[model samples]
Target chain A: MRSFIKLASVALAGLFSAQSWALNIFACEPEWGSLAKELAPEATIYSATTAYQDPHYIEARPSLVAKARKADMLVCTGAEMEVGWLPVLLRQAGNPRIQADQPGHLMAAEQVERLEVLQKVTRSMGDVHAGGNPHVHLDPHRLLQIAEVLRDRLMVVDAENSHHYRQRFVDFAARWALAIEQWEQQAAPLKGLQYVAYHKNFSYFAEWLGLQRLATLEPKPGVPPSAKHVQKLHNLLEGQSVLAVLTTAAQPTKNAERLARKLNSPAVVLPFSPGAEGAEDLYSLFQISIDRLLAAR
Target chain B: MKNISVWMAASAAVAFSSVADAQNRGRISSTEFNPAISLILDAGLAIYDNDEDYEIAGFPLGGEAGVAEEGFAINEIELVGSADVDDKFYGKITLGIHQDEGETELDIEEAFFQTTALPHGFTVKGGKFFSELGYLNVHHKHAWDFADAPLVYRALLGRQFNDTGLQARWIAPTETFLEVGAEWARGDAFPTGGSPQDGRGSAVLFAHIGGDIGASNSWQLGVSHLQADDVVTELGGHSHGGGDAPDNEFLGDVTISGVDFVYKWAPNGNAKQRNLKIQAEYFVREMDGEFEFEDAANAESGDGNIVADQTGWYVQAVYQFVPRWRVGLRYDQLDSDNQFSNVSFTGFGSADDLIEESGWADEDVKPARSTIMFDYSNSEFSRLRLQYSTEDSRHPGEEKDQQIFLQYVYSLGSHGAHRF
Candidate 1:
């Protein structure tokens, strides 16, 4: 009878461990959610903000709090990209597993070398991120580095699935590398293509393709464009050979179109993040963005 | 000596390289783990046709409930600081500065610490903080859609209910949103003065449930109740005495219950361009107590039992039709009923006069007001607003006051995220 009782206890423990094997991931944005899915396809993923929404400002909704409460891992593009709401949501979640410095907490931006890092920051900078630009995902090389960090973190948090995670990472990395090579070849024509954008959202993308940014519609980061600022930008780029006026799906297209009309160029709406139109995954997101730029040319 | 020199050169090389690396990384030399500090400045110019003393017909105002001063005035300047105290707790303090009657007044609006590492979706908060009794009470004044508190809040909650308190809240693990919380306060503020019941004066329970309606809409509904024992109010108490005048005091138990609802909509869940928010709250208060009167000049004293019931409500909607621009409309109404019993007086004036002075007698007129406002925000840090309101609550049928206000609010330094 004693042996039977011990066996029953062992069986119960196995059941509990099996239930915990499937990770619950809470991502601050759809891009991270998509990347996490690639690394751990078996994990359940929930994205707090969709591609159509701005990641900088979002409401700390109760549903998000509930998700954070149950998450086994929290993945986000940190560097104050989610400074507005993630802190509040973390405090409200009350889950120590995903707090800062915990193994389950992963900030993708911190793992990469950022661009546009400021020497001095003040409110007059118009919402500039002191840690640098948080839109590092647009650069596929930095994204690969972030993925390596994410895989290592996932293995540390869920050691039992380390082998499975490693295998998935290897396959994903190979495929991603091949895709990047093809994209670079296809986007070679975009090199030195002068363009205008609504915001500084495409800084990494432009850098990756060697695109020249003539000016932005917004005078400063996070500040809406005024007629005077637009007029100034138009004057600055009036005689230059501008490729196109660019905007993201999340930003208002009116200003971009107005500027495009003034410049006599096509207004291209790029899928800035995953889950946007024609950009259902990381691979498609870049493909669609490049296709849109080339189409404008 | 040669070895020492070689070691010093190696150390110098390492230090110089590290400094260069730091500069390449753009690390701020002045960066420190300091608490974030923000200051909000609010100033406004107001014009009112009727400048008589502002008062709700059946509600005695207390705390910071009053009309905005006429002409240009500094409305409120608030300094706020917040930080994570450590791994386990977060703390925040807010100091409010304003001008009152040609004098500057300072108030510690909120100081609180909340636990961050509690399990089972439970959080405990201690210190002086605003009571989460209603939807709008927890939000600071600068976050309000309108320039002033709603008439219901002014009449029933004395503008807002904030005091020294401890709170505990739990979020249920549901598909939708469900939250339950309770508070225990010292209750030394208005609506419950004197810190009765052995200094544990007030207790409150609140529950909220919310969910998103598709991708573009969200809504929240809440219910709350507050009970306070031994609330004391000085009705006509004064040191100077007049013939046939009585010094009256009220002592009683008070209970207030409220329900609030809020609905918000933004196109495709993006609020940067356009959004609409509609919110409403209704509150009912009941006071059961006795009025103790002392007629010092007539050398007589008497006691009377009084029961009062009051209700107030306001509904407002603000629509952001374009980026950085918004328009709003609000309506407020209030009602009260009072019953007096077992009063015998001699040479201390009539009971009618005492009841009227208490501001509890029903005058068969419901106080109401209508307001409209338009605001423009250059950015998230600065806002300018123009408001117009018609109020009949102060005099209630005597004359309605047409009021206009132009206000500006600006924030400097680091500001925390606003809660939904």
Candidate 2:
């Protein structure tokens, strides 16, 4: 009987050890979910918002609260980018591990330099992010920096998989650098190309590629374009040498298409993040964006 | 030499301006550490066809449950402040200001602290707050889709139920959403009177379950129960606008049970462009009490033992068919059954007169109303709405009241995110 009891204790210990290695990660957006997948292949991941959904205006659905309650770590693009709903979810989840300032809370935008930081902020400026533009994932250099920090975070949260996370980081960094080099060379001819976009969603991308954005479709940040505003823009750029009107798949295409038709240019729709059309992963996301731009030019 | 001197002047001007810009980058402001504060202003122009006293037969109203004043007026102004007190707790306070009979009145709408780091999916809240009795009761008036309260809410809950209380909630660890919560309140508010039972006048229990139906739809269903003891209430003296009627005092116990359901649909979980929301709630209440009235001038008096059963319901649908524009429709109704015995009266009235004066006479009229509204939001902070409603809850001989309201709500300063 004693030998049987010892055998039972051994089995229980084995089960506990196996469970510790399987971490649960909750990513606020699909881009971070993809990155987490690359780092910890064995862990379970859940992305709260998909590519088609706007991260800024998502609801704190019950399913999201459940996911957050069980999450071992949370990865988000924070600088108040998710100010609308993330706070409610965190408070409802009642999980101390993923609260702000904890080891399990990782905000990717905070790990790198941010662009478009405002000097003065007010509601008159529309829904401007005070900290900066939180779309830092579009810049390949900033993404690499965030990846390194995420790897370290993962190590701290799950120390048993430190070696695995480190090795994956080295591999991802090397491959990403090579892809950045190739993209730069391919995009060299597109320097100083003037364009118009739906929003400031592509600021980091345009800065990295030396593209000039003449204006945006929105009259102000987060405000939908009015007919008067659209007509005014048309009159301003009627006969100028504009390359194309660029927009994301998530944005409505009617305004962009109308403006593009008026300007006699193509309305190019790019995959804004992972899980979009032809953007199944991070690599394909950048590849498809550059490819679409080159094709449009 | 002349061209070189001009170039040097342009460079110097540019450098000086750049330095000035740098100096303006991060100025420290005096209100940096202040809590997030916001002010909401609600004003409206109301036109009604009937200029008589508003009363629903067989149901006495309490709290701020009444028809809007005729003509243009400021309905309410709400000042709210909220912030995290520390790592362990969050606190918020709201003050409501409104006009009352040519006088300005102020009331504390809510003041509460909620725990932030409670373990095992449990959270505790203390102080004064809105009771989670139904779906719409927890929301403020500014967040409502329409300008006025539903008829059922006005008749049964006195527009809404709130009190000084402590609440605890637990979220289950399930794939779908499930939550159970309970509240204990001082119950000095309407529907429960005088903080009875040693300051534990009322207790409430509620449970909710919800989930997403694919990417385009989501739903929630809830059930709640509330019970109060030793309630002492007054009904129908000055509110009836009849100078001869004496005030009736009620001593009783009350029990209320309700069920609420809500369904929302947005294409691909994106509500910015288009969405539809439908919600409904049904409640039943039982009151066992004694009613007494005395006419001092005539030395007339009355006393009776009474038992009443009341039911009310409202169903509403709001559709956002385009960006920044929405339209809604709501229908609500109320019914009551009253039984009186051991009735006696002196000098000026009979048992029937006592019953009629108490506003508990069963006239075979079920109060009901239908309302429709259209609104436009310029941004998240400002909205303008136009609403029309027709109600027939008055005495049998009175004509139905037709009402039209043009309302505007504007918010200033920082505001917290809305809860679903």
Candidate 3:
């Protein structure tokens, strides 16, 4: 009986060790965090955004640093979007898992189709980019691509869990594909729905959802709209019925309200991220944006 | 001075931190600790060769004031730590200590607490806080466009940053994210007086939302609004409040409003291609009081009551000519009418305010400056900058002064190089 008890104890120790050695994954932005959660429900998840903040300015908090310090995998958005602080976070996390060029580290952009390719890049074009556009996740195809990238990374950290990650990704993709079809069907009637937005951030979504590309609320990409620009937008859309003014939830509604009043339109606030106001999850975020955008009409 | 108090606190904290490290040393060897600490000590020697001698801060000063090399004089010690209080709260502090001009000053740079973990992504911080207003404002002195701050920042924000308050920031749940924060503080913005504000309150509300456009390219756009009231508004006026607002007689009723916009893009991260960043700000002010500008032609009690608007913008381009080497140039300009209040320099018989108000080619006594700078970043930790600046002030001879400063930065305490 005593010998039997010792065997059981040894087996229990091995079990505990296996659990402790689970693959460590670090997803940099919120969507990736949620996707990682969906892929590995039991794995420890470290996310930064919840429902109401900007991902670009997420503090590389100490807790994040501590998490990075031990991470065996790092996943993040690239395109210099995280440039202000991600480099510092990765360097300080003391974990070499996600260092650039490492197999364990991956930037989501490499997996997606680039848009808005700049033929001429110069200072004359206030803040020109060397790469095309970086906001790829607005397109589900890009997110699917990112999922594949993430799946490969998981495979690297836990060869045993590789099958599980791929399986999870497949399942997620099937559901995602179905959702995309639903979105297309729902947005079919809303094709060419005209609106003005505070930022060009929603362009990919607008394109995917079949929303018309009207004019931006801002005069330039990042610059505020002057009265003259507002007048110009009005002039350009003279023949079209601009149903509403749209902006992200994080944006102030002042300028949108002003423009909406001029056009006799309703000012609408859409969640740019999953879990922001109307967006409760990544899957529902796009659906709701397209659905509500049409409903607002 | 508050600087002395912060230094004392930092020293004590460092000593305490060492104790904690010694206890943790059992898990890790001291060999790992040595390199971690060396990041805290760096020194430099710079020689100043200004065309003229000057006095700043009402002190007996001269034009040529070059001391150490353009970077870290010595010992840029920083202690980064996080603490858990009970199960409900957690706090982080990044305290820095440096010896500048032989004074051991302490910067309680960043300290904040989170109510929850990364899941909620909500946090609140109170203490001497750093304003995330502009990119450069948030960059430590160790990382900057020049050895010193930009001219607009120094003149408008007073050398460092907006401080003396609590700020809360949160992130949204999406692949592309949005950030928003609000801050409240007691401080004077521009035109420093004999003392900083006492018991006055102001607020800054800001938000940034943008996303990745596609592969190899990413973009972000941000906007911030700052409003300050009941601030000590003494600019040789019987002035009242803060930024680009209108002029007043007693200045006790001016509200300064400032707005900022920023955009940045880089391919394959912020490197492997040219990276460009553009930032602009406009400040407008309004007052409820009458203006008593004795210098005004009208001489009306509310003569300076007219609102004043000012703007500043810079387009900087950085192209990595080769691996590990970058050359960049930035052109910055600021223009304002009634830059401060309706206070006229000739009225004060010193045209200094007039010189400071008008753009480069505007007022006879107007003072304005524009600069083009080229920077050479040796590595993540060191940089050398050569800037040629031209000041076309309302004042004839004092309008222009130019210099090239070599600034080098050495990081101590394990701060990592940032990548986009």
- The regions of model 3 sitting more than 4 angstroms off are A1-297, B1-50, B53-119, B188-200, B233-265, B270-309, B339-374, B397-399, B416-420
Report the C-alpha lDDT of model 1 over B1-420, residue by residue, as the tens digit: 113343345325532343344345444311344688889999999999976666677775666777788899999999999988888888999999999768999999999999987877789999989998899999999889988899889877878889898999998877787889999998776678778877788999999888888878989999999999888754433211223435656689889999999999999889888999999999998878887766555465566887878999999999999889999999999988867799766544777655555455567768899999999998788999999999877534567888898999999887778878
Q: Write the per-residue lDDT of candidate 2 for residues B329-365, one digit (tens) a residue.
A: 9998989998899988886457887677667775878
> Which residue pairs does candidate 2 place in steric collision?
none
In order, the Cα lDDT scores of the candidates are: 0.82, 0.83, 0.53
User: What are the per-residue Cα lDDT tens digits for candidate 2 across A1-297?
Assistant: 999989999989877865765788999999999999888877789999888777887888777888888788899988777877888798878777677745578877766667888878888888787777888898898888778777876766776666788999999999999999999999887789989998888989989999999999988888889878889999999988788898876777899999999999999988888988779989998999898888887
- List each candidate's DockQ score: 0.29, 0.22, 0.03
In terms of TM-score, which candidate is stronger, 2 or 3? 2
Per-residue CA lDDT of candidate 3, range B25-53, in tens? 22212123332222433334443344342
Best model number under DockQ: 1
Q: Alpha-carbon error at B367 in model 2, in Å?
A: 0.9
Residue B357, model 2: lDDT of: 61
What's model 1's interface RMSD, roughly to a tenth of an angstrom?
Answer: 10.9
User: What stretches of model 1 exceed 4 Å from their correct place?
Assistant: A1-20, B1-33, B233-249, B292-303, B344-348, B395-397
